[model samples]
Target: MMEEILYLGNIIFFIFLWRIILQVLLSVIQIFLKKDRSSTGDEYHRLYEESIEWMRQESRKSHRR
Candidate 1:
């Protein structure tokens, strides 16, 4: 009976350790994904600003004509 208890305890300990490892991996993946999304958003915002400026310049030229 004592041996059986020891075996069960070892199994439980291993399972707990495995869960902790998986949590750490998932956290790292989430951080990486957030960084990737922010970079893409920054690029899109810069392009939008440039297009708005171009439109304003064209409007001014049209008014001069």
Candidate 2:
């Protein structure tokens, strides 16, 4: 019957919505815990900048040779 089909559809929609909400909640919890694992902060960025600068210097030296 149409009524039964509508009820089933509603249940399916609710399940899907709940799953999406739980996934978002889990992701937030994971991100909160992930930050505790590292204390490096902006050090990785500084290292990257230093490496790039070194590469630029090497490139310039090679171009002159």
Candidate 3:
């Protein structure tokens, strides 16, 4: 019946709404508690150094031009 279909739709909607709320809350908590670990990694450090070297080279080239 139409009423049963409406009830099922409401149930599905509420379940979806609850999932979204929980995801938001958990993400907020993680943002407050989490620190970025990439900067601490060796790969990140190497990349940062490479970027700095590239910038210095570019500046030198621009100064010569």
Candidate 4:
């Protein structure tokens, strides 16, 4: 029947729409996670640099003595 065909077509259309929406949401989540990871990486890098500087100062003090 024509009504059944129309109902099936609508269902297919909705499925396609939902797929697109889900993809977009996943992309947004990925971007957010990447940003968070980068920020954490920067913090870790800063800590490493500070540790290196501290070690260098300790070495210099030992050499002076």
- Clashing pairs in model 1, backbone N/Cα/C closer than 3 A: none
Encode model 4's per-residue lDDT on 13-50: one tens digit a residue.
99999999999999999999999999999999999999
Maximum-TM-score candidate: 4
Query: Quick one: ranking by lDDT, best first?
Result: 4, 1, 2, 3
Q: Per-residue lDDT tens digits of candidate 3, residues 1-65?
A: 99999999999999999999999999988876555554457678898899999999999999999
Output the number of the lDDT-best candidate. 4
Q: What is the lDDT of residue 10 in candidate 3?
A: 100
Which portions of model 1 miss their true places by more than 4 Å?
Answer: none
TM-score for candidate 3: 0.52
Model 4 steric clash pairs:
none
lDDT of all the models against the reference? 0.98, 0.90, 0.89, 1.00
Candidate 3 residue pairs that clash: none
For model 4, give the 10-residue run with minimal summed lDDT: 21-30
Tens-digit lDDT string for candidate 1 (1-65): 99999999999999999999999999999999999999999999999999999999999999999
What lDDT does candidate 3 reach at residue 34?
54
* Order by TM-score, highest first: 4, 1, 2, 3
